[model samples]
Target: MIKVPIIKLRQNMIKKLTTFALILLVVSVTALPALGEDDENNFIALDHGYTVDYYKSYGAPAIQASITGDPEFERGETADLKIKIANVGVISGFKRLNANQKRINDSIEETIALKEMGEEEEATTAKDIEATLQSETKYIEVESTGNFQNVEELETGHTAPLSYTIKVDGNIPAGNYELLLPVTYQYQANVRTVTADAINLGITDVDYSREYKTKTEVLKIPLSIKSEPKFEVTNVSGSLIQGESKVVNITYKNTRETMAKDAFARIIVMSPLSTEKSTVRLGDIGPGEEKTASFEIKAAQDATVKKYGINSEIKYLDDDKNTKFSESMKVNLPLEATEEKFSVTGIAILLIIVIALYQIVNVHRKRNHNNENVSGDENEY
Candidate 1:
């Protein structure tokens, strides 16, 4: 309203514009740092989202073994045995999970944890981890205190044969024995990501590798040792005719480490065969000694022509002077048909028929002579 100089007015307007410009510059400078910080945080969150943490959790390998042959041994004897080794690891498909799989795995882990904490109502069951991870064995080693052969690089569900020879001590009491087999192997521990790439703000490509570790454990295997009265039947000599009684001689060997005193071999005759003398006395048998026993056995008339098994055992006086019975053993005897006897019976039957026919012809001739004489007399009258 008051008249002012034009130059002063121009100065005032410039000053006001300069002050507004300064205020704008200050505001811009302060706000720019916060925006930059927010942008950096967003980038960091995206990078973290692309990484998977569930790949680090995994279990060890489980190895098992079994005997491939007979697991029985006698005292003071050497046994040759074979063993089969197998890897039964529960995990499978290792190092094959993607980012989405990782997320699913993380969710599964959370569910498992909740269930473990007794929150069953709130927990969800996840897919089995054993089906998700592909497990493998890098190498395997085996050892035993007695005798064993080691194997290497055994695969999952595959078996490797190991041979061993062991000697049983003479004084070892007869019982079940446990043999410990120490097994060692390496297995994949965890997979690590070295680098990763992004595509359209998503995790797409990654370079990773696996780490391995070693584990050692012992497994027990069972075996049996025979007692002091062990007996085995060998060198059986006899043939049984289908309809007749025959004498059989069986050779028995004492495979024990001690002597059996006042010993007798007893047999139980099975079907299709019968025996009156079921036992034979063998005075005394020492370790690794053989003795023979004879028995009279009769086979049934309708018995099949084949080998038959006789169950037999040994009764003897032990070192304590007490009577004991050994385990049952099988004795094999063969029965055969007597075709030559049948041929002889057939010939005898044919001879008897010829004699009867000769007698009948002689009688018929005599009767014809008598009838002719009577007819001539009647004509004379």
Candidate 2:
């Protein structure tokens, strides 16, 4: 070989040293336990298993995965991925070591029942019971690995599982892809010491396990949606003067599984008679629930004699947009069935005054004409 250049050898040595130093720094940071001071009660870490048994709930251990391709996605095309997670966890365990270095293990069992508790509160208490079962892993800790969007704290047995879908860019290539995910966990631990039955002055120490790291699996699942809405008019009857105010009642039912927001009820009168038309907004109605809107309608004094057709529409917003559910009813307001009374004496008094004033004006007019004729005759003579 040709003689080696000292300058080239020196440059290569420097490059190797710089790369080695960077790798060493990375290893030191990752191998170190999770951030936050570790004490008798707290233990934090990354890339390792947590002391908390994550399998207590069917929905816990949230794992999400996604894949994207180059050149963007096309319309009506899809790239799918499968998502999976380890659903198994150690529910509870206990162990003892004798003086002879003999080891013993047992499962702790306890029952707690609070009678007459509300359903939601009962479920929450069940989770707390599960946490208590993991008494050995009672130390608290925190760590970050960048996979999750934010820091998540998981108490023993108190976490619920989560799942989500990632739509692949339609134009992506049909191949396998991978991404580096960073995740963090903050947790606390509580350990049991001596029991009341223990006679010796010896003490026992409990330890919570370290945090864990695993890959996330993502899958493609399409969305499904449906809706139904119903309308009714209850307590539709009203009592008021022919020209006064009356109350109309309408009930709107969101028969659909989705919430109906910004809902409104429009009551239109089919009868032409001086109609009381009212439109009322009932706001939001939860799924499977009914809400009522009441409005006052004033009839005209000369309202029609026949029964009137009262129609209403319950308008609401669905995923597709605005929709209307309709209902109609015929209300009997028989004007002839009820009579209005006025004072006959008041009418007679008003007629008598009019006749007296007419007679006085006629007599005055005759006297004026006779005086005018006499004046003319005297002038001719």
Candidate 3:
């Protein structure tokens, strides 16, 4: 069993999560509007803008991420996990940097300075967000590419979803798992008035000079691997010789908590390998119980002499008597190269045939020689 990282939720974070409603209300009413306009008029287009330093804000963007739907999942499941990110940070408070309300009251400069402070209030708005999702355990894997996601902007109390494809190990135990999402983004750190340059740039109100700072925060997403009956091929018996049929014994053990009722082992064989009986009945497989099923599989004569991985699964009745199939498992069977062999009687018969043919040829040669010798003697006389 792979260990799940023990997470210690910060006391402060729990309180912030519970204040979603308040955050939503404040974001709806007081969320800072975008500082610039659509055209080129709002941009100063200069090396720098003038500063006012009327006020300074204290809070920063606070990011929170969570799985959007039910986090519970079954083993051997592949799914697209959607994560929701929200900025729940508020402007905590603001300090008067150089405000002299008695003297600057109702002045044109004062109005412009306050307008600039509105831009400064955007410290809680996160921008140019990049979130990278990661997994620590081998039991769960992030399969999809681009695990690093980008978001142009996410304001306070506004949520955004990130999609990542993941695969769960069939043998992973039932428990809570944590996925880490480290998010980096820039937020408005300081803002100042740039009204002095607005006139020179021919813009109505170049408005504010904005300064940004980058921050990174990691958010933990919790996922539950559901408890269920899991099976694996523990042992394989019998060798497969080419051009011959053999009964292969495969033992399957339920490694999980749930009991598999009326389970039947089913195997799938492709070319070069064939099975007359693909399925064998295994009455019941309880927790940690091993069940062996014998399948008669034949290897073709031309089959390669290598380890063949045959796919197999389990079909069984669930708690409601509904049929369910387990994830595909591999049955590694070695196919031995065919070799020729002869019995003692067959070898003896072959040797006798060879000897009899040799003796007959020898006798024919001897008779021919004697006839030749008789002809020679008549000629001599």
Candidate with the greatest lDDT versus the true structure: 3
For this target, which candidate reaches the highest TM-score against the unseen true structure?
3
Tens-place lDDT digits, model 1, residues 1-381: 899999999999999999987876674454333333333221222234333433334344566777787887766666666767666654433332333333346676554333322311111111111101111211111223434345545545556666666667755667777666666565555443323433323222323323445666676667777667678887899889998999999899988777999999999997789999999999899999999999999999999999998899899998888897877889888999955555788989999999999999999999999999999999999
Q: Model 2: how large is the Cα RMSD against the reference? A: 21.3
lDDT of 2 by residue, 198-257 (tens): 212111232322322332223332221123444444445454355666675656665545
* Superposed Cα deviation of residue 240, candidate 3 (Å): 10
Give the candidates in order of lDDT, highest first: 3, 1, 2
TM-score for predicted model 2 compared with the true structure: 0.29
lDDT of 1: 0.64
Question: Which window of ten consecutive residues has the lowest lDDT sum in model 3?
Answer: 39-48
Q: How close is every model to the real structure, measured as TM-score?
A: 0.36, 0.29, 0.60
Model 1 clashing residue pairs (backbone): 92-133, 92-134, 92-135, 93-133, 93-134, 94-134
Clashing pairs in 3: none
lDDT of 3 at 258: 84
- Report the poorest 10 consecutive residues by lDDT, candidate 1: 126-135
